[model samples]
Target: MKNVTSLASGAVTALVLSLGLAGGAAAEDFEWPRLLVIGTPGTSSGSFASTNGWGPILQKETGTTVRIVPEDSETQRYRRLTDREDIAISSVSASEMRYQIQGIDGYSQTKPVAQRILWHHNDTPWGYVVAGDSPVKSVQDIKNGGVRITQGVFSPPMVSAVTVGLPAMLGMSEDEVAEKIEFVPASSYAENCRSVVEGKSDIAYCSPISSVLSEMEGAPGSIRWLDLDPSDKEGWNAYLAERPMLIPAEIEMGVKTARGVNGATSNFVYSVPATADVDFAYNMAKWFHESFDAYKGTHPLATRMSMDQFRKYLNRTPLPVHEGTVKYLREIGQWSDEDDTWNNKAIETMDAWIAARQEALKAAQEQGIEVNFENQEFLDLMKEKTAGVENFQSRL
Candidate 1:
């Protein structure tokens, strides 16, 4: 009887061990799709240090393995998207995406990426910076010339948009202004800041009220921010309309001081978060909109993330709303049938505008009028005026 009992115990132990091993094998066999996140290097330390900015949070929310692919430059980040990567996050402006999808620029090597833009988020602001002791006080002051502003370190798209595209919208050519100011390229934030302090550059172009901007605040009264001229409201507004991210923002001194100038009011920077994929963009939009508190808890910049802000900034642009996001917005009654009608009409109008521009270009070419692709302003005005007509047609 003792031998028989010992044999039974041994059998039970072996059975338990076998079941445990089988269970472990089954668990190991279950695979999850790896999420790839692409980001620009050196901008967000928090993002890099912590798993690609949203990787950790997303992984915790969804039971998937998140991987962050950090690229050394913005161009590299966008170029990587050509591969069959699962997800990528990079600083692609709305205009850049539009041009890429249309194959307007040199991005012809890559096919148009079929992904949903999840959500557009705010970036740090871009504004003119000057020496604290300098007599220049406003965007207008620099317009008269004698002031040299440095772009510092910016992505190719950013450079194109700001220097070429933005000035083009204002009916002024960046090249025309080239003789008036010096354009110095500083690629890194540290290098740009050092240039300003060392007097190698006069005004530095950067975002307003960023951690980097805050660091420059300690520049011992050597540098100050220039306000956009209120008189140039038309130009500014036109630029803002074209670039939805360029919202009106004030730089308060006490709230955030720059170079010891505590409470000055200036329209310095506008933050915008942009994406290329519409469905994912929609999901991201809804997620961020609904989970505002969660995001704000992660970063203070998220304070501007709101439904109203989305309607105000996003709806005005030529970019298409992610279908998923559109669905969410409609379900929440944030968007109406009229809004849909308007969007459809707007799209049709854009198509018409592009067609018209092509026709005009052909006509001009027949007449031997030199078509300057380098002049971005002319192209923008053509698009803007066309979009306006489309808006009117939609209303009818």
Candidate 2:
């Protein structure tokens, strides 16, 4: 990756130096939409708030009326983008794409959506959190048994983190982790953290920016995030075994509650379907890069949307990047040969999974079995059949 100014320092400098850049910028040859819609998580979500913060700036700068839609369900948002293509782009995580592509878990009956990545916007550095008064100080302390870990019932990403990702981080199997930790059900992401505050669950995974953390911090029990020593290569290796998309970037400017903890971050991007117009993707990326000075202060997370941070995590995304965005990245000398190799491999893997989903659906029909995530027989059949395909495993 090319060396560039960090967002923390560069954002403020750009604000002072290039205050007039967006206003005086020349119009591009590519056409701009009068109205642009961006799909994101519910209004209560940080991602949604982030868009709301910067959406207006984008609209004012580009003369596009940016409309933001909030959907609480990731699968619903994924379906909207893939099946309907009503929204210009939908904010999604790498792990969510992994499940959607494989048609696993909540995506059991659905076909793999053909979405391509646009850019790495910002990263959320989060970890398993506990009440300040709880006995758990580090991740190691959770293995003592009798501890309750919040298992998000509605959110598959949260469920995967607690059930699979967290355990792998500790070098333990899901079965082994289950034996030690009591899994408490949580209805949503907010409820997961609220459970910790309410004392219904001892621990829950969360980020400092989450609005619920204030409640957790002010609660009688207080809030404490379990440490995951960054220098421990063995521990991280195990964690990446299950979640390769997660980055160990430090949370230097995180909320007061997150200070002095190991920083493990996951980048969320605004992705579009493969069939999206090439010029649309190209312009969206180019606009964000050029208008950094105008939108950096619109939201705290918006500052991280700079080209520097985008390139830092560009090579880490597991999804197939859109060709239009690739054109921009290549023009800027950010896309390397290694990136092309990784991107091609990811595209091949995605195509294989899409084909496997079709085969799985056909086999289920022939066997007179209902296709459902809850149906263990159908799940097993999918696993058995797709096991031979190259890069067939789910990253979540």
On a 0 to 1 TM-score scale, where does candidate 2 land against the true structure? 0.74
Taking every candidate in turn, the Cα RMSD to the unseen true structure, in Å, is 13.8, 9.4
Per residue, candidate 1 scores C-alpha lDDT tens digits across 85-145 of 3224543544445444443444433333433233554433455566677677765565576
lDDT (0 to 1) per candidate = 0.47, 0.74
Ten contiguous residues minimizing lDDT sum, candidate 1: 1-10
Candidate 1, superposed: residue stretches over 4 Å from native: 1-85, 88-96, 104-106, 113-116, 151-197, 209-212, 229-233, 237-255, 258-285, 300-309, 336-342, 345-396
